[model samples]
Target: MERLDGARGPRSPDRRGLPARGLRRGHPPAHRRERPGDHARDRGLGIALSPGFLSAFVFPSFRRLWIGAFLSSIGTWTQDVALSWLIHTRIGDPFYLGLRTFASELPLVTFMLVGGAQADRVDRRRILLVSQVFQMSMAGALGVLYGLERLGIGAILVIAFLTGLAQSQSAPTYQATLTSLVPHDHIPNAVALNSLQFNLSRAIGPVIAGLLLARVGTGACFAANVLSFVAVIVAIARIELPPVAALGRESLGQSLKAGIRHVVESPILSALTLLGATASLLAFPLITFLPVLAGDVLHTGAPGYSLLLTSLGVGAIAGAVTTAHRGSVPGRGKLMLLAFMACGAATVGAVLSGRQWLAMALLAAAGFSLTTAFSTLNSLVQEHAPNELRGRVLSIFGLAFRGGMPVGSLVAGGLVNAFGAPAVLAAFASALFLIAAAIRLRNARLRAL
Candidate 1:
């Protein structure tokens, strides 16, 4: 049998009474024992699924938080579908669509550093509560505008930008809280489960939104989102987080410098971030343009758009489950490379498929690849980061992850206007996957991590 360290163990003796060199004296000769570090590596990759894995999610504090977050996320997705549809109907301008993307993502680029510092300096639970309140208020405002028949493209953009700002602040605190909720050994599982919840909501949310949109109206979707935040807020109130450790005294500038230095020094992390940014720049803009694609390209309407969203969500959920079941990180570099390839191929296939069913299937394939690549990158970053700077590093990671969308939106909009949606998507997908594959082959650190 192959040994864990990529070395062969001693062979067993023949049927005769001849001893085998380096073999133990037994009928079934013992293989070389796995090194301690090898075992740890296996565990990190989710290869060893033990009973202890359950502890990551069953812990009371994390359970409440997870449940609350899942509920709120469902509402969040519902609102996103509604808002996208609303914008498509009101104004189908590609530049405006790009601006909508900017509204949702610009805050992360601007305020994520401050958000990270605040997560380290203040109470994370409180920060989450405040941010949830801000988001809920924005949702309520949108609902009111919709009810009053005063909602405009400008109003939606403004509200989206404001809510995104709140999300930027909340994200760092949310990520930091996971470490305190679970033991170190189960951190990988915890992260996977967290992703599972988000994707689960993603899977269900659009279906619900489609039903609600058909039965009720867009205003109902916004109101539902406003109400959904309450569950998370209450759950946050019910739980008690562990006390924060005293940080070493340092000036804000010094602390910021240290965080930057840490990220810069880690070649694996730096490469992962860069690769992820490129992929996001290429692939993430699809969500913003799905409405256009469904209506114009596929000759389908709202229900068709919902199906597209659901397919993506289902694919993401499948990817999350696959990761959880594997119980360890895989060869991330290879997986990432494969994911990019799959994503690119699927994108091209999606645009080319004339049949609606075929198009949805291609999109599902793309979604699965996209989510797996992203989740693997996230797990790697969290596993390797020091606790002191974890929040800051993750904030930078989030910034890279989300910030690419706006840039992609701009590029996609221009391409769609100049050439066409299919041509633009095909070109973007081809360039991105090819570049990602090249990067994976060139960067050893990215492969090994």
Candidate 2:
């Protein structure tokens, strides 16, 4: 057995009178040893006794929050599918689709810094609750408008913008809350579980949306999302959070500047943010253009598109699970870089594939690699962030993660119009791969991290 400090336990004599390397002599194995808060604490649930992918659930608070968030995320994905389909069918223009997506994400990139600053100054739980309420109301309004046959593209865009605005507030607080829910050592597992739930929903939600759209129309999808917020709100209210140390009030401008300065000054933060944003800009746009690949290249239409998306989601879930299982394993920085390179390579392969099966397999591999790289990066960010500035730091990270996708999509769309999807996407993937390699070669310290 190995101790927490990476030392082997004392060995005992075997039947042949030889010291057995695998057998511990004097004490129980490391996991059997008790630590603080080992007993049942919340709703009669005890801490998980063994280490694995599910280790983060040992904390009741994290478990509750995760379950609630997972449920809500599924509903959100359902709405996303239904809304996208509705826009595409109604508008019959890719421009409107791109516009809607851009409108939705713009607030997140622009206003989340303010939200992060406020998260540091106020109660995070309250911020989360209020955001949920705002989102729920927007969802309800969408359902009502659609049901009344008054839903227009402009109204949808406005609602989408408002919904994203609410998310801008909740996203940073949600990221920072993970630190309070689990011990510092378990942060990797927590972050992995977070990614796992989101990807799992991605795999499941679209199918549900499809069924609802066929049988009951888009209103049902919107209504389901509205109801989903109740679960997270209740969970947030019931869980007990540790009191935060008071941070003296600072102007939002000062707070934003401080956060940006910190990220710019720290070599690790700067590299991580740059790499993450680059991936978003280059690799993630593949997802935005998957429909083009499905229709123009593969001639597989909607069903094939759905299958490709499912493969991506399933692979991402696997990646998150693997990261969680590894926990705080050493050499994560090296592993992250390898995954980043692998994702780019797999995406390139997928774009060049002539057969649907080959494309699907490569896409799956790309998804797995991308999620592994991203989750590891997220874990490192959380580990390094100070408590007082954690929300702001994470918000900056969130911007890098999300803000690039829309711009990338627009650029890739224009390029696709000129050169075609396969050629353009392949070039982007190659760029991603080469960039990651260059970063790896130049930064020996990053490899050591």
Candidate 3:
């Protein structure tokens, strides 16, 4: 059955498709670093797990790390909103707007696999430290450039790409190590809590940026974000994790290949990847053109733009809470299906609505659906992947999560300039509905969850 001595043979697959060694103590996966407290948790030794969200926070280390991550995410959203507003208002070009989105996400597709392999082989904390430093520098540069009136679209894109590159390198490591700070039973709650922090920041950051954008300026938002990186770097240093056993490292290519092979063999994992990629490529690009939506349709100026983004964030937070509570529910695929249909309906309704308030309401619905679909997909990967392959699997998830947005954005950006945001959005929304239906019907694995 299960062994803790780090030696084992392949066991039979469970419903989750987790590898045999995954449940054992055989060769340590990238993320499994055994510690004293963990040994106790594993053996159910003198510990009681709390119900719902409270359980994840019982560990002092996880709570501190969550706080830091929340602060950093808020800063990131602040910078993102400020930068997009600056590009749209100053340059007034939809193509550049699309290019900006593309630059930021491109590295996620290209470098994330290597980053995943690195997480398995190297010190994850070091990776986070380096990435944070690069992001801090980039934010500082943006603020300086804006203050000096030297900021241009080209320079902005380059900075965005560099910061994105840094994020791509560090995210897999951070995600892989997430469960290390908590007991095995709390991983679901932990993941849900992590989503909550991000979505909360998503809502709050844009609202704060909106106020600053109209009053002080974009530079102020950028400056605030620059300071936020400090929290994450400090958190990483303060949290002491279990000692990771030393193991021989694999070459980057071989390591990546192994990860790819794992996904290829796993039916459920492949379905999850397709689910995210389709949503990203088709449904998400519409989100990038929010500036155009406000300016052209609503004519509500900066405040209207801000409110629309806030609605999305608010809805996302609701979705995260629902997911957190659904941890005990076994039907992930069924939930994702309902959410996808809702997302499609909401997108179409938002596009067609003539009034600003109605559009915002519809977008909130879309936001809720988006979180449900993606987060459920994410949880599937975490549950099914073994500890050693966790980073690589999550990296593939990250790749699917991020890769399609740029291609869609770039395409939509050009078409928006020619036809308009509404026409392009409507076209993609229709395509997304059809794609979801086809994929859902064909993949029994996705339907069954």
Candidate 4:
């Protein structure tokens, strides 16, 4: 079978029957189109990249970015766990936990669109470079504060907010760049590989952070995260891209409106946004509250918290790797629906399970399902949107993806205090399952996708 770009029709495979090659100058990138037939469906789900799943990797720029992103992700996961543990042990309140999560995400909601607009208007590589520097400084500052034993919850929140703001600038640029690095035909492969890198880092970073926290302290993980940014910076410096031709500049307000209008007008984008938002709001809150569960319900210390995070990451890795290998699966809408249900089911199981290992296992299952579903959706969004609007389209995705998780975390943080973590999680998980089923039943077009 030949590889298919969800847009721009079927790609001609090379002598070895792999997608001919990745994006290069002289050859314009594939334009966007709505995939409405079985062939379109196959492009969405049945991406048949043979001669191995690493075909996109044949492109030097993408491979460099891929490796760089993977290293950077590992550092991020390490810092994330360490920070959560620090806040949990230091603040010792569920409200603070939620507050911390909110602080991290509030910046994304506020600045993501602006960032997306900037990505469209400027050199994405420069955006990444500046953001990486900003984030590295924040991480280093946190490490120093922690080492001095002077970091308060307020300071922690401040730094988290700052780092998230930098992320807002970087994420859309990075995401939009992936499209440029590979030809349209290999997009699904690129998206899956990126997810695979993320989950693999997620799987390992926490365990490493766990060990460091158990023995050395949080400072080590923070310092490691600082170096990780440098790795990505260097990678960006080394990879060369063609000079972007100037487009007619729009005012910031106009650019913002244009991006939002695109998403609002596209049914598939709107529907996917709805599902991702709901799931993030009701179901993904579990991630923000996992440390609380570790401490209150399981009575495990930092080690237990790390183990729990590692379990989820491990499951996510499995899911990402499977998707990367399979290339595609038919009926993506149904896959997302199933994945959403599985996440809720797993959360329910975790809520009921009293034992730590059992809870970890269930969380792992939930992670697997959630990652698989979202990665597919991510690919779809990347494929469906026109190249000109890629940054803006993905920014809308970033808003839904990062924006909802924090607000949910904030709410869950307070709700857990009132109703207990177990009860709060169970209630929301049930709600999520019902919502998913209802959408599946009502939206035939969603199913067709």
Per-model TM-score versus the true fold: 0.86, 0.87, 0.87, 0.88
Cα lDDT tens digits, model 4, 107-126, are 87788888878778887767
Candidate 2 lDDT over 381-409, as tens digits, reads 88888877898898888788778766777
Candidate 1 at 162: error in angstroms?
Answer: 1.2
Query: Considering TM-score, where higher is better, how would the candidates rank from best to worst?
Result: 4, 3, 2, 1
Please report, as a residue range, the 10-residue window in candidate 2 with the lowest summed lDDT.
1-10
Q: Using lDDT, rank the candidates from best to worst.
A: 4, 2, 3, 1
**Which ranges of candidate 4 are over 4 A from the true structure?**
1-52, 242-245
Error of 4 at 281 (Å): 1.4
Superior candidate under TM-score, 1 versus 2: 2
| Candidate 2 RMSD computed on C-alpha atoms after optimal superposition onto the true structure | 10.6
Local accuracy of candidate 1 as per-residue lDDT tens digits, 36-71: 233234323434334433445444455566677778
Among all windows of 10 consecutive residues in model 4, the one with the lowest summed lDDT is 1-10
Q: How many clashing pairs in candidate 2?
A: 0
Backbone N/Cα/C clashes per model: 5, 0, 2, 1
Question: What is the lDDT for 419 in model 3?
Answer: 94
Off by over 4 Å in 1: 1-55
- For candidate 1, the 10 contiguous residues with the lowest summed lDDT are 2-11
Model 3 TM-score is 0.87
